[model samples]
Target: MGQLCLVAVMVGALTLALYVDAGRQAEQNAMERMRSLAASLAVNPFVIDAVQSPNPTALLQPYAVDVMDSAHADFVTIMQTDRTRFTHRYPSEIGGTFAGSIDDALAGRTVNQMQDGPLGPTIRGIAPIYSNDGRIVAVVSTGVTVENNNSQLLERLPLIIAIAATLLAGGAIVAVGLRRYLQRVTFGRGPEEIGQMYAFYDAVLHSIDDGMLLLSPGGELVLHNDRAAELLGLTLREGVSAEHSAATGQLPSELVSLLASGKTVENEVVLVGDRVLLVSQRAARTGGKAGSSLGTLVILRDRTDLRKLSSELDTVHTMADALRSQTHEHANRLHTMVTLVELGKGDEAVRFATDDLAQGQRLTDRVMESVDEPVLSALLVGKTAQADERGIELSIVTEGRIPSGLIDVHDAVTILGNLIDNALDAVAEQASPDDRWVEIELIASATELVLTVIDGGPGLRGVSPDDILRRGYTSKPGNGFGRGVGLALVTQAVRRSRGTLSVQDRATASEGARFTVVLPITSDANLNGNTAPVTPTPDRKAPQ
Candidate 1:
């Protein structure tokens, strides 16, 4: 519509300009013709001879009338060099002075000007009549009155109007066609509506908590939300290809591969820097199911905190299972003691109860002596009961005692708890339950905390130590939601604490895997002589 209106205005202006130019040109041509006629009359012998006659008006007046009719002039006048009229179209005005400038004509020049005369306003021309001796003898003037010029222009007014109307009609048609084309291109939306939709969509895209990515079919990034850039730790710019993104080493190579593959991926766990993201991707189609694919939509949900919470939940479940097992074991022990007393074997019952109490007390004392952190002590006790229920021997060996306030409970549980659970799983895989045994060692000093877990099971089978810590990399496979994040979580906790984790496979002795973690303990005044909780940095790089 705007285009249409603009075109209309332009066409109207052009038409007006054309009309004005044409009218000006016509008026100029009329003036030039009058000037030429006047000069021609001044050069005529009859007018020059009459101007010198004793009775000039009789000879020139009739001649002037004849010239006016032939040249289509409004009036013709013959005047002397002294401005006295020799002949005039009005006979009564003969012998009177002309009413317009004759100084140029008297000075022997031909000229034209617009002036008011006896008849009215006119475009008049004057030319000098010179004798053979080169002296001005008379002046001849010709004019076209303003009224007559306007009548001539009026005769062509209809044609000018017709052209203008035609042009206006053509412009209107073109404008209407252009307006329809614009409407089709814009999906029938007005400018205001389109602007509103753009603003709404932009707000919604950035407002989401999860990261969103839109990619072309060729794997070029089309759009990305703010959260996507924040989560991935990369400045996302539009039109960058997946290959280029991977080359920067900021985005994970695995994620790039998935994007380039153009295949649908669901709930796939991917490690981007130090953050774990649950990534889902689908091909974006233009229309329905059979429509062509336009691009791919990728969503990244931050699972770092969620995975930690899941790890904590797993610990809670393990503790509950251990408690249930302990309760059952205590019931059996009570039954045995009751039967012994009822069968008249009071000494045997006493010895049986004494040995049971002694073993339980020993395990509790070992855990208490090794770990001063209540969380770690409680975790180890729960593991002991779990190991006992599985008929596996669990031992806690301490070379140096861990002090209270030296570690965050969550971090300690995540690292050591996951390690013990993985060992337990390895030991449980053994065919001989009697041979299943796990050992844990805790060593702490003023500077560092060291933990080690070893199991009596088949070793890593030449698996790389780094490979075991990769998320979703597991030998024992089952379709479980939280199956393979244990070692990965352990690695994350260790790294956050600025610690080191090492895995040793004893392929010869014991044929088991040994895992060790060393965490540095900081004793700053701000921390009140306690170990500061390890917090992951925003730009921390994850292990490859």
Candidate 2:
């Protein structure tokens, strides 16, 4: 019953995810089409290049609306900036005010809508068209009603229900499906015979997560489940390939090498800004029977955050140890130095350990200054001390003032904090007394914040950039200890800040690698840049 319940929950979740994915895909397609249409209308020769053109129809005359013209086909419309319909699907109403948010878009924003139109509630897209002077002139409105989507769902519903009822095989498990032959074979039989000999197989060449795809034995993509299109970051169009994505960010060379070898392989990969996918393959079965394999199965999970949190936990553990050591050594070292001064061997003892201890103390002191926030400064200060404790030289050089209002404080801390921590790990991975070091640089400008972490270890090698940013790809050799999640989180946060992260082999370094993150600085000139101060509302407020 527990297994059955788990299956049911998975099935239901799969259904919900599919439903949401379909809606999102449809909306995205509609918006892209709207943006393209708006761009086209803005660049129309009749509107821009012609003199004394027909006031309304001339701009729209050369291009017809992109939809089936049947009575049941979903339709779109357009309007002028002043709430006046310029041209729409019902050509007679070219000057009539359209019943939608076309007017809203004319005020200079894209309008994505599900609203009641004269033609019924439609999932409409309205975008502003700009003139030569960059003024909002006309709005392009496009839509397909939910009824159209419902029609698509109805067409797929029967297939979904049939598969659900069949309890089709998923993962490595074989399951029951409809066949009179199976019933006859199972009749009057023992458990083993009934299970193995009597079982009839149903092979579903689709995955239940993100996207699914099946490749034929000839190494061609035979079928693409919906999520596969998304995971590959492709529209449901032809010619999406594994090679295309590998060109953009990076994928494990091992996985790609395996694919190139044309042999069955299952491997996990992280698609930057997408998610982790578990891709596997086996021989495709035939004739609804066992012992046949023909194709590969690809599945995806949005483990983008889970993998991130896991690594953050690890850095936390490392940090905890660093702090523990710092605490243990601070007063004890002070007392020991005092005792050494009282002894006759004071000068010799001071010469031996004072220089390194002073280096550690200097690192700690430098880390604590010029920070507005305590938590961040404290964490970094402790990390700095711990780094010194491990014999790694730490340095922070700033070119100019660290911009105060450039980034959200929390975001700044997380991005820089995690990166520094990761640098410490990379350096400590292969740290030796002679070659123990890391450098952190804060090069800030009015428009950009450049954070670079250079370390001395094995440096960046043996992995693609994607593998470096992937969550679970860890260098620490252990079953349950360290996993590489910090880089993934940093990548995500950097993306959110509209920044870029670059990793390069530190050619000058004797040991480790260097990573640079450039983050955009949001200058305070724009009125929207100023956020309201955090003030508690009257009744909701604790005090004045």
Candidate 3:
């Protein structure tokens, strides 16, 4: 609307200017024409001779009338030097005094002016007529009437209207086009609404804990919040147009490539150094789905802490499962003893109880003697029970005693528990009971710790080891929410401890997978300043 109004005003102003110029030009043309006609008549020999005659009015009147008719002038007058008319349109006034000033004509000069006469307002030109001896004898005046000039001006009305219409049409077209463009880009929002939305956007961008980045379609850094800068370790300034690659060149190559590709991504877990970030990328557009593209929006959520907590929760759940199995087994044994006592077989009952106790104690002793860390020990016990319940043989082998505080308990549990769980899931799919077996080897040295898990199931033949370790690479079928993050978390923990991981086909089995992880066990492994030894007691509460 504003644009239209402005265009309208401009068109009107231009039309008015043209109209004023036309009027001025018309008046100028009329004045020039009248002056030339009067000057020519003043020098006519017939008029000069007649003015010198004893009776000038009779001689000049008819000739003056003929000249007026031929020249198409409104009125032509011939008067003496004393300003007495000799010839006029009104014969009765021919001898009368002229009604307008003739002082310039007496001074032997020509004159042109607008004056009111018997014919009303007119543009008249007066000139002095000279005798043969150069003496001023009479004066001649000719004029174009104001009404006739106005009629001539009215003749150009159609042209003025045409020009004005063209201007109006062009202005309206441009104004409407501009308005439509603004409507699309601004989503039909007014200036006030756009301002309000910008304010809200600014507040939300800085206030959110997650990192947000807006990139241009040409891979330029359009905007990013403080959190995004902090997460990506960027030093950015407002209004600087930095190329996307140069701005984020210090980041992981995979992440930078993903951003540069401008593809739509959702909930992609990317590891940046030791940080586990959940990233999502989406296209930013001006309108709906069919609208023009603005750029891409990349949102980053730090999941490092969440992943750690989740791994710890898995460990706790494993312990709970182990305790439940222990409780159930103890109850069954007690029931058996009660039955024996009721049936008067006390000696047999004692022998049966001693055998069960020895079996449980021996397994516990073996686990404690190998790995003295409470969390790993407890995790192994839970996983063993879980495997036994599924009719799979689980074995734990250790090269040396792995004492407590060699590494973080949480990290150890995350690495060992996720590995064991994956192994169990693998061997559980075997059709033959004898083929379903998993072996864990723990080797602890002065400088490093190595953990290996082997499962008798389908080996990773078609997939690369690096590919399987990436987040969201899972072959097992489930709800798929958390199926693929285990190995990724293991890899993250291993990298945080400056470790290396390897996956291959099991050497002892024809069809099985083996995963081995080596982590530094020295003080250099404490990369996050968490060198303090983890307490031996495990947190038993379930994660909420």
Q: What would the C-alpha RMSD of candidate 3 be, to one decimal place?
A: 8.7
Q: Which candidate achieves the best TM-score against the true structure?
A: 1
Cα deviation of 471 in candidate 3 (Å)? Answer: 1.8
Q: What TM value does model 1 have?
A: 0.65
- The lDDT, on a scale of 0 to 1, for candidate 3 is 0.80
Q: In candidate 3, list every pair of residues with a backbone clash.
A: none
Q: How would you encode candidate 1's per-residue C-alpha lDDT over 423-462 as one tens digit per residue?
A: 8888888887644888887766557777888888787878
lDDT of 3 by residue, 299-346 (tens): 998877786678778987998888887888789889999999999999
Of 2 and 3, the candidate ranking higher by lDDT: 3
Worst 10 residues of 1 by lDDT: 535-544
- Give candidate 3 regions above 4 Å deviation: 4-172, 213-224, 231-251, 256-266, 281-298, 338-348, 506-508, 524-544
- Model 2 lDDT, full chain set: 0.58
The lDDT of each candidate is 0.80, 0.58, 0.80
How far residue 62's Cα lies from its native spot in candidate 2, in Å, is 91
Task: Write candidate 2's Cα lDDT for 377-485 as tens digits.
Answer: 5556666767767767776754444534566555665677777776777767663554567677666555666777777767666777655765435666654222454
How many Å off is the CA of 284 in candidate 1? 3.8
Better of 1 and 2 by lDDT: 1
Better of 1 and 2 by TM-score: 1
Using alpha carbons, what is the TM-score of model 3?
0.63
| Candidate 2 backbone overlaps, count | 12
